[model samples]
Target: FAAVVGSVQDGGLPHAGCRCDNCQRAWADPAARAYVVSLALVDARGEQAAVYLIDATPDIKFQLEMVGEWLGPHPQRPQRINQPAAIFLTHAHMGHVAGLSQLSFESMAVQNLPVYGSVKLVGMLQETELWRPLVSQLDLLPIADEQTIVLAEGLSITPIGVPHRDEWGTGTYGFKIDGPAKSLFYMPDIDSLAQWAAAETVLNSVDVALVDAAFYDAGELRGRAAVRHASIHDTLAFWEKIDSQLVLTHFNHTNPLLNPAAPERAAVQAAGATLAETGMVFALD
Candidate 1:
């Protein structure tokens, strides 16, 4: 099964300093708050369940707590939760990899935890003096584009390189996870569907796809520079003919879809696409 630990974009709900209507609602109500996008993949076929986290968001501490049952307890410290078996990163973006600091010596202090990402991403972590200490504490594994890594018997993950804003020349990847009887594709960030040649083919191949829906439309990006995320309107139109269970995630703080009462939210439901929420679980088999 895959668990959605967080559903909002990078900065999360109630963004840094914004006081927008949506942010105001989130600030006033704790229940309305959301964390950055991330997924937890669990395989419980064996005596002890194995758990893997996809994209270590800044909200990792609370996100980890959400899956504490599967993580169990730390072997050495019963009071603490055990670290995930491994973490697969989609990109080096702040939202995706910032949680690594939480696992460093100052916090979780995880030892030899396997962290996988692109060759360039892993290299940056290894070579950068600022991150060298964190790198030393982890087992950095660089995976190639389209390389499939088998986890347990029927559980495997293949990283599919995609087009996204890459300031450091480190490529972005969207994960295709194949479980025993079902498959899931997770792409939290992407510039645009039209830019990726295999967007339709790869997305349709999966049984369920949790894709990027950072903004409701271009109107949400009033004063911002040319943003790259695909709007909800565009995304729905693109996947209208696809049969896969399309779930929208990684919403920006200003997105209208975040409001349940918003007509845009109703429109999305009418289109047969789901709006992802934290703690939502999807069974693989």
Candidate 2:
């Protein structure tokens, strides 16, 4: 099963300092709070399952518990460690890679954790003074664009380069997970649909597509400069071109789609797309 563990943008629900209606509701209701966008793939066909995470989100602690049963028992500790077979980082963004700190000596102290990312990403982790200590504990594996990493007999993940803000020149990745049953394309952060030359072809090749839905429209940006993310409006415009099941995610705090009663939700549904929600599980076997 593939679990959508978290469904909000970087900062998560009850955003750092925002007091919007949705943020207020998130603060008041624990259930309303969402972690950063992350996905976990669990191979549940055998007696024991293997787990792999798409991103090391800030909420890794809680997100790991969500899949504790599948992770099974830890070798040394009484409690199960949040150890995935490996973690395939999409990029070096705060929401995506910040959770690596949890696996360091100060916390989980996980040894030889395989962290797969671009070559530059691995370098950044090792070169950065603050993260050097944590980097030592990890087995950093470099992944190239379109390179496939086999997880098990019937499961593999390929990281495809996508256009986005590449601060360190490492670039961004949208993974194509080939499961026993079908393929899943997860493009969490992309500048625009038009920028990707193979956007249509790659999206159509997959069975499910969990794409960036950071904002609904220009209004969400308000006075701030536009972020390099695809709006739900643009995503819907290409709905008919995508042959796979579409699921929108990585919603910013200002997105109106967070409101259950918002017309944007109805519009997205009417256009044949669904919003990603925490705990939503898709079968891989």
Candidate 3:
């Protein structure tokens, strides 16, 4: 399935190494924007084949190489497939596709890595000077919402829209994956679940959901009480409405999760939700 944490700046990347507490006051230090690359998806045959990466995180080279190794066997032992199935993306943030350039000739020398995204996002990539150049050389494909992308007999992906900063594209989205064994809903970033109309249908249908946990408690960070990011993501107070098994991820430095023993931590556990840990893996199938 999808690979998490691929970035050069481990803290700046979403899925790699975000800790807790970089309050607004801390931003003056230029180190509070902690993040990690988040990529996810499974393949055909209900396996992690045709792995779809949600973002082309900064650590794309090493991450893809790892995916390739897992999908197939190593060169010495070789499995079944030749390459990763595909890649999907949310907004064109630097953490999302910074690895695209590395996939080009100057970097790892990988080939057309069918990257799927919304229409405007595709155009953004095309119109941009850097990623646009990759399209001319690499095989980047475009996709739309509700478009059923068939990876193979048992694996298919349908993009569902979510609201976010759209300067680079229109509405961003979470993904609904259909495989032989089970389904998963992954929305790494969204302003608020209330912003989505079909949020109920999307969350209820999946066996597991990896939702935004960029913030653990509101107003925990100094001077961030009025900031939107401080209030947007699913708060510990709002977990009761969701009916699926939840795994909170996409953490920020200000998040209380950096401390496993915090009251917020106790709150998440009492609610039956799990936290996303680095190097965590699961086989839905």
Candidate 4:
């Protein structure tokens, strides 16, 4: 099963120092807090299931705990850390790679685990003085665009290049994960639907597509320039005819869809696209 571990955008719900309505409500209620977006794929066909994390979000500690059953107990060390089989990073964004520090000697001290990312991403992680020691424990495998990596006999992942906010020109990827029984397309941070020529074809090919839904409308931006992410309304319109199950995720704190009663949420559901939530699972065929 591929689980949706966390669903809020980079900063997560109740974003730091913001007093927006949603943020304020989240601050007042523990139930309202949402972690940064991340996904986990668990292969439970064997005695010990192998777990792979899609992104090492800032909330990775809690996200790991959420999948403790699959991770099981540490084999040789004390039971303080439950490690995933590997970590695949899509980019170098703070929210996406922040939790990498947790694996350092100061924290979990995971040993010799596989960490996959672009060439530049792996180089940056290894060359950065602050992360050098911790990353030394990781086997950084640089993945090329469109290259397929086999996880198991019937499961594989391919990195699909996509356009996004590339600060250092390090490419961004939207993974195409093919499982035994079904396929999944994860495009958590694309700039816009118009930018990708293969968007429709790719969405039509997958069983489920968890896409970028960082904003609900342009109003959320106030007078500031709109960033790279696409609004939910835009996604709904463009993906309305796709055969795959369109699941919206990576929500910014200001997005109205976070409110259960909000019309935005209703609109998405009525249009047949599901909203991603923590712990939501999709069985791979």
Q: Rate the local accuracy (lDDT) of all candidates.
A: 0.92, 0.89, 0.64, 0.89
Judging by lDDT, tell me the better candidate of 2 and 3: 2
Colliding pairs, model 1: none
**Candidate of highest lDDT:** 1
TM-score of each: 0.98, 0.97, 0.79, 0.97
Residues 158-221, model 2: lDDT tens digits: 9999999988898899999998888999989998988899999999998999999998887777
Question: How many residue pairs in model 3 have overlapping backbones?
Answer: 19
| Runs in model 1 lying further than 4 Å from the true structure | 223-225
Report the lDDT tens digits of candidate 1 across residue range 137-192: 99999999999999999999999998888999889999999999999999999888
In model 2, the runs with Cα more than 4 Å from the true position are none
**In TM-score terms, which candidate is top?**
1
Candidate 3 lDDT, tens digit per residue, 83-123?
45567887666667676777676765556667788888777
